[model samples]
Target chain A: MGNNPHDAGLTEGPAPMDEQLVAYLDGELDDESSRRLEQQLASDSTLRDQLSRLERTWDALDELERIEVDQEFTRTTIEMVALAAEREHQEEERRRPARRRRQWLLGLAAIVLACFAGFAGTWYFLPDPNRQLIEDLPVLQRLDEYQLIDTIEFLKLLRDRQLFPAKTEDASTVREASPVVAAGPSAVNREVGAGVAGKREYEKNRARIEAMAPGDKRQLSDNWRRFDKLSDEKQEELRNLHGALQLEGDREELERVMEAYCEWASDKLSAPELSHLDRLLPAERIEQVAAYKASPRRQFGRRDGFWDMARNPYGTRWFGRGVSGSSVKEYADALKTWAGRYVADRAEVLAELLPREEGTKWKAGLAKAPADDPEQVKSRWIYLVRWYLAGPKQDMPIDGEDVASLEALLSPNARKFFEQIPPEAKKREIPVGLRRMIGFHFQTGQPEFENLIAAEDLDRFRKTLSVDMEENLRKFPSAEKQNEWVRFAYFQSKLPRDARSSRDDRHSPGSARPPYGPPSHDGPSGPRRGPGGEPREPGDGPRGMRPGPAGIPPPPADQPAEKR
Target chain B: MLEVRDDNAATFEELMLRYQNRVITFLEHHTGNHELAKDLAQDVFMRVWRARKDYVPGAKFSTWLFTITSNVAKNAQRSRSRRHEVNLEGRDSGPLGVRPLEAMAQVSSGQIPARALDRAEVRDVVWMAVQSLNERQRAAVLLSKFEGMSYAEIAETMGMSVQAIKSLLSRARTNLREVLEPYFDFGSPPETSDDADSS
Candidate 1:
């Protein structure tokens, strides 16, 4: 073996002969190399013997069994890929909101800069006196109202009195408007013009002041200067009181309440009683006010006037009768009943609108509610709706039908805009999509949905409705309902020209014709027509009239027929 | 592969079907364990799936796949070495650091009766001979022989230069010849200890 060429070659580091022979066997060598190796192999018996052994060993590896994975392996591999895809999709979904928030922040920054530029331009042109007035505009606008209420504590007491009647606006609307107020501590630093919406309101007020007569301007300026004279803490308290009143709806009602409280406090309370009232906490002050009303010592011949002033300042009854304990319970009960009925009527629609898991949870909650106790059921439903709505909007379940209807309603440009959204987001329910579209439409004014209705038809629709779109939005009982109606109107607006013309031709002289088409009398509970056969106001359109194909009513299950 | 990169499941399944057996056979020969080869083959395909998104369509898809296979096999070997667990199917060590095949060779060469070996026994002898090579040598030889990969393709898959692959295959073939020549020349089992001693 030592004398053999193969044994000598193997003893050395990779011999060229061994590499050539292995490459030749593996067909890795070029033809020239193979020929060279073959010549060497024929001439050298040892090299030929070495090549044969390599070939035999390579061939012996063929005895290793062929591996065939079962169908289960293929199935599992596919499942693993699918699971990975879903995880990636969910990760993308998780990242989407942060991206959207960045976009929203960019948009908000642009708006803020534009507003700042406008304000800077105004300030640059304004005289010193007018500039000071502009600086104090928020406080000046409510100067008389704040003047009547000396302290925030007194304002809190008056609020506790329930003297200001709650506005008829829906609770959801108020909640949507005052997020800072609902969030508590953050609301403290959020002055009147701190945010985008507040800035717009501030700009509107500024324009109103700019247009004011000289006498009115002078009066407001004097009020501002007087407000400026107050100590810093007092000024902050007054500003906070104004903010609190603003956060509550109906500032005019609050002003009346302030006036009544001021008049009643000065007349009814002795000096020490007034001092005592001021020292007490809010709840204690409320109790003290009730005590003063009941006390014979302070009871003058105007006891009836005291009761009238304290309980019902404005002759009309409010949600609760008075600040009395029983009346507070009544108010709570009334609010619950209203919320419960609202939720119960729209339960199915709301359920469909929630995410699958949340919808299931909501249904389970409703199922578990005490059937014998209606109040408990209503409270349970309210809790479920609130909990579900408080979560992220991306988690909201979208009804495919609603998305389809909303897409159909979009104008050509709007449809293009909708198509530009990711496919993953296109299936989102109407409220989110409609709100986005409406925001975009207003921001850009590109007639995204405007062209769906002709000018004359839109004018007719607006005149017949007797309110602008903003007021129409306010009239909806819930945010979801508002979106639903907007979606419905848009859908109706896109009806074919021939269809509308033929429907108008068939319309009787006394019958109301909606701008989309003639009202569908075939469906039960079709929209109510006005006296002169005009379309009823938008919010007044029958709650049951869900927009279906060609403005027909959807199935009964989808229709929340009960009034909000 | 491009279709797989675009998240087409059917194309991925088809690719798996076309390559699964070959991958498993290569891993089995590389690892010398059937069950582990099946498991590692799945891991190789999973790596393929994960890497699909970043897969550039330049190299042959098989080259990319076998590259993943080589890494996975190397990692499995490294971990098994760390665990200090002897791979019983491909046991290279016997008494006194001598391989079991060397002992069998000695036994067959001695007066110990040489029984008529069946096809399974020949396969086992061949498996022990292949396993007697070092990890890189085993991979190079198995890929070149069973996978029918060229030296350049094997180098690409193993992340080595072609010259290195040529040298590797030369040394691997020499080792295999040393281990399998006795069994090929005579009816005796191969000597697995001499290659270990030489390396």
Candidate 2:
């Protein structure tokens, strides 16, 4: 509609003519514009050329590839939408329960308003049965234990007297420090919190009750009925006892004591006598129980058997089973054979346990001993086996001096590997390996000192030493001494080149190499001394020089070991 | 579409079957990445499913669907730019950087030998030229050229005025002409330029 003749013909630069030309190519122009564009295209060569270019470029867009999505895309999209819908539905369901509870409360309120006096009487005299069950669920869970005791006072008196002793020999030692009465009310209160804890306990009890089988549920209900008939004072006492027994540490000990007492009372006392004792006061009842335990009539024929049974009810009666001397000999021979095989398997670790002279002599004796001489072989096997078993128990604390000696004994490659461990990790890893080396030397007897030295580092330690050092190490009479020299050489190599030459001149190989002494706090070659220049401790001898049980020497403290 | 709005699942599936290929094709051309296009196409359909309860049946369903598609695509492009990971297929060139066709521009401008390009090369040239357009211009051109929507429908799909869409299409065509006209007229391939027109 504009009167510019230039606009009718296509011009550049945001002109309406460009839009008209594009629209004309797209067949989107109005009739008047289409007619005018056609007339202009026929006469104006520039406009025709411009239209041709637009038409050609627009058509070239068809060259872009057509794309098709696979069936999986459709399937996954449907699944995603379905999952979203299900989540929405679940959200609605979660909201419905609160709404239902509100409606129930409103209905209850209306009924109460309509018949206040009647509802109050019913609610007071016959409270909701389900609510009562939930409130008493904790007691119902332990109804069987409560049914046996007349009152908590009686149980407390029984525990105070220590009438039910531990049935096992070791059990007495384990439980001696943690007596049932020692756990005070404050401890119990600390263990169990109020309010939130109470609600959680109720929910837990309800879930357990609901999961019980129908027959068990019926029996529980029966117990509840019997329990319900007790006086309110008795019910309160039983509930208090149950809550006290729920304390974690005391529960197991008290349960065991109760079990032992129950078993003994049922076996010895008559039902009438038991009932009579229960009717007495807790103090008098416990006194009577103690008297019955010590009675001459109860002990006349079966004191030893009863005490033995009390001491170890689950233990096999190996001592009382009579056997011939020949049978005993046969058993001893079998045990000797097993011990010999075990000693042979751990020969390297056992060798490390003795002094250089003793170990060399023992190895020579074993090599020369006649294979068919059972007596000599048995004696040799017993020597090594005794050393293995009679060493320090597995749980012994690793001495810090022993750990320092072990660190001084690491080979060059192992030292490199050990130094790379972060300092915090070294504190943990060094002790674990040292403990295994000391306590389970037989198990760690495989090559490479498996617990202490990594296999690759051990291999490199043996393979990478100079010809002179290897020759010097081979001259040592025992593996332990050879290891000490390797460690000394590794430390020597760490010194500055000039200092090493001076130290080597003074400690030349033939002049009796210095004893494997404790590491010095000062420079590498300084005297080994404690912080105040005191002498080293007794156990600070060379590796494997520490005294073992029965006067035998245990293995030298080896390298810092790690669990593989 | 009304059935789909009423939560008719079978109708939704039918609609997906009808539109999946078209939607994926449009997105693939729009984003220059087939896998991302598939992901974005699924996202578009997912939004439609989520907003089904609010869907009103006035505009054409493809138009409504493309509106969601346009928004999803733009959001993806915006985030991709924010991450500074806008290169096409890990090539150091795309709409926001130097165009891949700069090398081809060198070839067209006779710095390199003018060998006859293959069909796939020509297709790639056209794809790069399309991708060089700005986000809105690219969406508009794709909707117009592939979807065959009128200027009004493109305006509705892009949430722009009819005049803006007209201007957008005109500039896009003019850009394509600058890049592709030589290829269409001669054996030389299309070259993307530094100052290629974009809205």
Candidate 3:
């Protein structure tokens, strides 16, 4: 009997005949199993009844299969299959070239890499021309210090002693020479003109300096290149004066002047100005004297001050450090207001200047200009303002007609500002705003020579450079170089046409001549001396060495400052 | 298949003609869209021709052909669902001669009679019931009844076990009986009385 629940009612049970009946209906079973199931179906009425039911249910599903496809179905399917076969063959053919091209590219890359590797290996062993320039960076940095030395012979003596490293092949031969006692013929001219006490000071300092280690001597040599160019006696006088300043007593007026010379050197006063400092207004002279006074505490005697001078003498660090916190907040607020006004103005200008579609493109490009950095945001706004004022040529060629046309576009105050500018400045197609900056710098007497403009104004001025000029400037794009260019532009305005024509000959790109003018601003005492050399009672030097009424004060009761 | 693999176009045409209606019928029952069924059937034959080079005949040509047909139908249904529209009301011309219900229902008076529908109406009722089964059950029932495939053959075609095919058909039968029993009169189906009596 099959163990079927439905058949259980007919014969207590049948041995799994229900599933076998389904298998028999589907023809899934082998002949033996099928025949057996059929025999069971014939003999057992109940099992036979179950098979009949399965047969009827299965047949009923044929009602779903009644769909007779259209007569065109077969033909269409064959056509499609044939078409697909042809397409696949063509597709394979199409892919063959791309596969070949990819393989070719890979092969080419491998060959190029091999060639590069071989070239790099060979280049590593060749001599590099700029090697000495890179190695001498420390010496070049200390060039201002070197300028303090007055006697070339004394420098040669030091070079012979191996205190200074040879900077070139010619210098190397001098390093091996024996020291001689006789002063060279230029000795008379070498008098630093620092009077007798200054002479004594040099002898005294020489004793202590002579005792210093070779490395310490080398460091001093590295810093004082100008000292070598000094006339012989001036070198001796400066050496003596450097020693006397270390003493805490009175010095002669001559020693004071020599002390002032060293101070000017340390301050890195530009070369042309350094040579003429003595004749400068007492205010400028006062700076040279204060530079001496500030030295003992600011640099020579203090480690931090020395490093500060070594790393950045001009205080250009201000560019990155920005102003104090309160000023930053003020600048930030001002920037926000300025940006808002420019954007509003830009909308009307863009609508007037461009067709609607192109206007939207312009708007999108301007939108991508960065706004996060206040300087960059100000630059972008300045660019847009100039674009509006200068019209299509953002950079108008410096000519009177163009300048007048640009001025016509400016506000009343801006036009009035340009009206006051010198006729010479009007001839250059300089941006109106930059002309204002230059005029303000000259009026202020060029305070902070390199950093003549405020940081915000400097950012805007840079955006005014011709695109080509701006690209050329990017090669040496340090904050210092940018300031140099700003300073150069101001000086360029001052140059006669002939001088302006030879502008590139005046200085290298990085160190253009400082604006040709007297120094101004800030000194230790009352108002800084006007360019008119006014005299004031001298203050004690950095240590307490004062220049008394008589030339040299008698040595103080305290054991005389150490003499060699 | 061997002749087709040898690049015999005539042999391939013969094979396609033999199965075209069967494939279309299976797809029609699966998708309930005669136009889509026709499209899918054409794609199935296209694939069979493309894959002819890789063909190795197994148990039955119908099994292999219907396996491809089953896959094509499922892929079409999946894509159709993603397209997010289903025309359950049948085609504008009615799917494969199974007239839309509005027309079919009009032939009968007011309420549908308890008695079996005529040939056209029966086909429509069966198609609707077939669509009601989930995809797997629908495939199982169609392959089993229309192709007369044994449980093993259906299992191989549908990628399921023989036991799974049995359960699938069992469940499908239960669902069809529920939806159709009202109209079918199970034992005879009216027109097949001789076959019922013989059993």
Candidate 4:
């Protein structure tokens, strides 16, 4: 009757009795409902029977008893709660100063913004033609007129041009017009009868006479009309000695003159190079300075490679000079190799960090992937490198559209692994191939590398390589032989599997190892071979077959090219 | 509640003493283990103390107190499932007393007359019947009988509506009547397995 099949005989055709019965048995019914159920129970045997059973079940739950709880339980809980509160209080106190500093920075930024707005408004709206004309006045004036003119002569020209109007021939008028020169023979008095051009010439010579020293001034006073036309360089040289000539003590004057040439040389040297030289002992500093002066001037043309640009301290590269193009390429290759070495080092670190199963999976991933396509390999490497460099905690937002492509390229686990790598490790252990790639990519305007390798660092790297190159040249008979020696250096350093230590001494190149280039997927295998396709010796390869160009100086006769 | 919120330690201890026995009784019936009930009761009071500042005092103190009790019970039940302990043998004594099977045998002995069970036997019989119900029904019945809460008050404490509470209690009573009617000698128990009463 009330969709109440589950209630069975309790209800006929009215509201369901299931809830009513449960409530009634629990004494939850209102007064009206309670009276109604009571009346029904008195009249109906079936209703009374249902009520009786429900009451029995409800009353049966009274069997559960209140048991005693240990007193120590209450004591320990209160202690824990107090400790938690105290910890929270300390944390809040620690954060107060940091919060105050953030507020102060916000206030300062607002003040600076307001001041800039006001200054911009004034500069844009205010316009005065007289001010504009004064700025433009220089373009209208002729150069020859000012060449012989001192400060006073220019003011007279200003008046002659009617830029300033004169009042009369009064004392006050002359004082205001030329206060600096009023005590001398005034320009106004000269203009009264003398030829205008002749008067200009007289004033120029008079100004020169006043500025000269006592000896020159006395000679000028004797023949004030004629002046010697000394060359510009001689004039500058003479002027440089002027302070010393005026010294009161003869001994001090002589000392100053004697040190002038050294002062001139100091200005010509590179500041960093000179500072480094200063740190050396006096004897060493002298030798270094001599070597620097004798070092041939390298043409650092714009066409020259990055290595040449690195060698020049001032960073000026001309179009036509320095090392040959091939040598520049060789240095560039070494940098690229160094970058590759860094990546390999990081791979070793990664292998250690990965769990056993994951490490195996990663190795499989690398082995299964194609190694022939360099671009694909590079892209995969870059993806890992980019994620590694961003740091573990970095949250990079990706568009919904990009999710599929990223998932296709890298597995979710691999992506998470990259995120977990700490950035501090990335900075300290720059992957060998990454630095050169970053430098080259950033050459096209990548700003991320600004912190990685600054200009100063690049210069230092170049200087070290340049020194290595010089040493290499002196060790080999020719440039071709040196290049050949570098290719086989790594393998030759270690003897064949059975070779003895005594054999190592026969060909060891000492501690001077050649720069190792980046490893290729199909790197050289087996034994080493020289450029001529012959097995290389331990130290220097076969030499003295031919000499290179004139620029390469020969080694000392006692140490032959083949003996290195 | 305000005294505890203000860090009055004595007031908090007094409150704990008043409610500790009631909480332990409810949890023992719900879990069918008196020892676990005592531990869970301690946890409930600790939570109340920790969350004292958050209390608004809108509801009765018992209502707030029981809410935390229900939460701790539910969390412990979930962890127990994940751990999947196959047997809890040799741990017959719970927060209350002996195992339900042993209690059933003691109550069923020919020596005890129907309707004349001793207080200890009655408590055991009732606890055995409570274990027959599911977790929610057990909690609902414990709150109603032990705490003396009405349908609406139980609903508020358990985060359910009054109508739902009434339905829950009805089903719970039907299940209990079937399990308990035999002990009272009113009717025979239906052919049922005791495996479902392992709680």
Candidate 5:
């Protein structure tokens, strides 16, 4: 989400801060921060003049507070009027199905057309699944050169025989899972767990994000402190020149502060550079430095703190906001392009009897997705992600997409997968296009059975299924995954366990955290239609309508309308 | 008889009700206009509503609410100035602290009237002073002078190092002093120091 952060803290360059003035005004020093400000006020006419103006503005603003309302108004006056309007509109939703159907058709068609404006109206997309997640291609090549098909065979055998050779370190050390301990009637059971080191990384980043802005506050105090420190005569001289150099976002304002400081320092230390030093530092950097310098001592350091060299996303290696690097931009643009596809890339094919212009109308047709509401937004995003993941719905907005745009859109989810992908499969992201081979990453057959499963995948999963599962379990061996794996092995174990073993230990140990949840690209294709709206014609001018973004399933697939 | 943190929603709602009118009044005073004040006040509640999900019981909620409100008011001021967001370096408060918005998509079709200054002065000179502050300094001043928060409380709410809080409050005061030098000098209270202060 961020870029290289060299001088990131200096977003506006260093501006000016009158430290003496700040110290004098706040009286935070041993004599109170304002002691310094009072001292400077005696000598600095210009700084004193600026203070006087601020005092007047505050007075005028204070009078602005006299406006009053009727007692204890729990709700706004406008809500009553809005509520009436809302009622009137809700009644209309009952009678608009026919009109909506037509509109939906037109909208879907239009959206599909808009998406394919680049592809000359060809609705088909053939995203080389390999090309989509090429963040680490060498890893893919390494998997190709070693351990592709035989691994899956071993996995199946392991599961089939229930041969669970859990490492001794893992067997006893696997943390036990506890059920939610209800605390109240309608109990909202909350678990405030600091997630493993990974989630902690995110939390740290988020906190740092929260703290960064207020740094600007100290800039003012620093300037005030500087101003308060000045000789009375010097303060008067600086203030007379119009003490306008006190804004937070602009650092050049510091030049004036620096000028005053310079003039005063020149008198005090006789260093000529003291005057122009503000010019060299710049307003933005000065603001950053002044802001950081003015703040109190930090207790947290790089070791156990928010941002250290190891994980600070805004480290010097990263490019700052401007045009600093090309490779990063290329990656960023690729990411954005992928993110865009997730929003609206898939198509919905309606009956040929349906019109073509309103394919994407379903999006806007969404029951009033008002921008101001977050609950509505959160609900919508969840719905969208689910609908895409679940499958192409007959009622969903598949009316106008050509396959290519759908491919472009669907690719982002794959990229998201890349973002959250486990390291074991990290090596198999890229496909080596040698001999037009298909390398699908499904099925765990024997080493010789690798040829039996002629994959269209680079076989990333097949290459490291056991190893990755073991690692993931090692990270967080939750009872859910373990139990799921146990249940699955019990069903698949087919072996008659010694015909007399203990009833509880019927199924011998198998791998914990079985790979049960992969998006099913299997089974017969769902109902399909082309531009001509032919009923059940799969892959004609374009491929079948796939789920738009990430085909994530909704929490309750049975009742899609009911939120989880 | 009861652990107060049990129903945070009730507590938070109580906190909101207790401070809602006070905050609106503060905004009106700060902006010198009631309508803008109301809008900012509404925005403040919207934040208090969302921040509920992140609420931790051990900490005081008022401090958190004040921080959120101060950030929202300042951000609203910036967006009103010119829609392009140069997001504040610190993220103590702001709606987008949740996630980045499609800020570039919405273009201003000139909602603010272009009124020429009566005398060769700047527009919304008060806003210029506020907008000039870094995010934290502005929030600190808003909480202290406008929201009437004590320094130690502000530190807890802001989650800053006290020295940092001191610098922030001091800088804010200095800026206010520089801007309102012509006004009254009724030195309200002594500087807040943690060594001798408690709830």
Candidate 6:
């Protein structure tokens, strides 16, 4: 009759006498039945084992029923609960914003609203909490980063339209096809206009010696100025004389000497002579001297040999035509140099990431807890973390055992550092405080982030970053820029409440936002390419008709300190 | 990466504060040490918070939440280091060495201790056996033995599926067997000895 078995049809072996034991122990069993079991158990080892198991089960139940927690643990976790509430409370209060329509009315607006409500019976509608956050009732822009960006943008726009002519996007295009490089005129050019021999004598003497050097066109513009300055009588006399013996009025002897000297000169200097023949020769039925410089052997127009030396730089640069082998190789070498910088650092972000995700969530709550519920809620906590001071002690190389052990102790947490990180990338969590500035989840190969950093001007821009954010920006710059773009990231991550924007700016010398060391350098260094590597001219985007400034030179990329 | 949205953390904390005192009382009773009990209570809160990100709303909140609480406390107690340590030093204080349970007795059975157990020896013996059980064994005993949790409900709170929890309770009983063997022979058989040993 007592061929009792393991829980009938159960996979595991052996049925526990646990239920009966509890009933028997609690005296819930009827006296006759309890007595029968007591009689059987007196000598039965198997039944006794079952009984023992049941009795211990009862013992544990009793013990667990009566245990309590430590006073400190309860108080501490409770305090954390209160903190989150307090912060949220303060934030909600601070986040209150005003209506623009109300602002438009100003002193009269409130009255107008009242009047409209009274007369038209305009029952104003308010949106749901989520919808209110969505609607542009008032931005969170009244304070912190948003406010600062708003002002800066306003000033920038004002300056772009008012102070500067607004450098056109095509201005760079004008660089290559350089207009005549008219500089401040030389004194000789002036003296020549005054028709003085003072400069001409100097040119004639220089030209005599220069004429001896083969193919040399040294100081052509200079000589031309001096020659123009020489008194017309000296010029006319020289023009009439023997060597100046107007070879059909090739009149300028200096011109002949300079051209003859070009053939023997080491290398050409000035460009070939220009076709301003009308000035050199009279509109005469005159003879030409092909070999005027060498009695019967040479030509006398300004030497046309130094063509390469006097090549047009603007044309070369604009057309990309004049690529001297030397400089072209320099650019190629530089490209190689840049490629070498692509190294993979060994440091990982897992340690920073996982704990924050797990710890903060754990710190915050129990399942089914309401946002404002103070009691009856199971407030989560980073208990082992708090006990062991887990956040700071975590190192990248910790063993999985330690990792799992630590994890087994705590719970999930809030988006601390990398709030912008997508769900999938946040494999491990970071601590709340460090997480704020650290959790951007861009993978190494993302093109959007890469292209932005690859722009020519990124190097220049990187040089300007603040130290706090620079190291972060280095491994991940474009995202950092995006972090900057949403003006609130710094304010969000850096714990704005604890370190309020310094009202006195820098009353605390050793503080995070200390007295100014240097100005923030990231105002865009000229224009840069977009995520697609397309050149993003500043002013052309959605913001306005103009872009960021051209001359505000971005800081260097190497300096980690200024990145933030 | 446990992604606890900031909003979720706030929600979780609210959950903790709501249930903390009761859960602490439960943990204290189970662990027999207020400090360990509190620590276990915190674990329950943290576990629920961590796990709740995926919590679907179909189940009763208390059921789901308590399920986690009970599971965490049991697991903590069953951990290798804690395996041998029993909750012998119950922290709940009251007249007659049972304040919390006395309150429970008032709520459940409604019978004063005097009416239920006139003999002090029986109560002492009952408590002595209870102190010998391990964590899950104790929880199984309490929930089933005292609080009257179904195998299924006990399974949910302890994070085990029903079958697994059942097996666990069975193992817990086996553990309880050893502690109860001598006690039972000493306590219950005496009443029946008049029929046998006396004969």
Badly placed stretches (over 4 Å) of model 2 are: A1-13, A96-564, B88-117, B185-188, B191-193
> What residue runs in model 4 are displaced by over 4 Å at the alpha carbon?
A1-15, A85-564, B86-117, B186-199
Per-residue lDDT of model 5, residues A1-564, tens digit only: 123222122222211234333333344445654565567678866556544433444433322122333323334422322233244334544566866756644544443333233222221243432221121111111111111111222222322332232233432222111011011001011122233542343344334334533422232222333333345664443332221211223323222233233222222211111212322333333443344334442211111101111111111111111211122234333433332333333323321112333324444433354434433433333223223222222222322232233223322323343334354322222111000011000011112212321233224323433553333322211333222222222221211222112211111011000122232111111122235743421111112122111111011112111100
DockQ of each: 0.08, 0.09, 0.06, 0.08, 0.04, 0.04
| Candidate 6 C-alpha error for residue A284, in Å | 99
Clash number by candidate, in order: 3, 6, 30, 22, 130, 100
Please tell me the interface RMSD, in Å, for model 2: 41.1
Docking class of 6: incorrect
Docking verdict class for candidate 1: incorrect
- In model 5, the number of clashes is 130
Which of candidates 1 and 2 is the stronger one according to DockQ?
2
TM-score per candidate, chains pooled? 0.35, 0.35, 0.32, 0.34, 0.24, 0.25
Deviating ranges (above 4 Å) for candidate 3: A1-18, A29-50, A92-564, B57-59, B82-84, B91-117, B185-199
For residues B51-135, what per-residue lDDT tens digits would candidate 4 score against the true structure? 8888886668898899889878878766765875321211221212212222222223312211112333434445656775767
Deviation in Å, model 5, residue A247 alpha carbon: 52
Query: Over the stretch B1-199, how does candidate 5's per-residue lDDT look in tens digits?
Result: 0122332233333454457666775564444345676778767765655445566766666677666766666667567547543322211111111100101001011111111010001112233345445556656666665555666777876777765676665455444433322111110111111011111
Clashes of 3: 30
The 0-to-1 C-alpha lDDT of every candidate, in the order given, reads 0.51, 0.51, 0.43, 0.41, 0.31, 0.33
User: In terms of DockQ, which candidate is stronger, 2 or 3?
Assistant: 2
lDDT of 2 by residue, B1-199 (tens): 8987865555676688678878988898888777789899989988998888777768589999999998999999888878755333422121121122232222223332212112234455577678757788789998997788999999989989998888888877776665553333221223222224534
| By DockQ: ranked, best first | 2, 1, 4, 3, 5, 6
Write out fnat for all predictions, comma-separated.
0.22, 0.24, 0.15, 0.22, 0.05, 0.09
lDDT of 4: 0.41
Candidates 1 and 3: which is better by lDDT?
1
lDDT of 5 at A522: 13
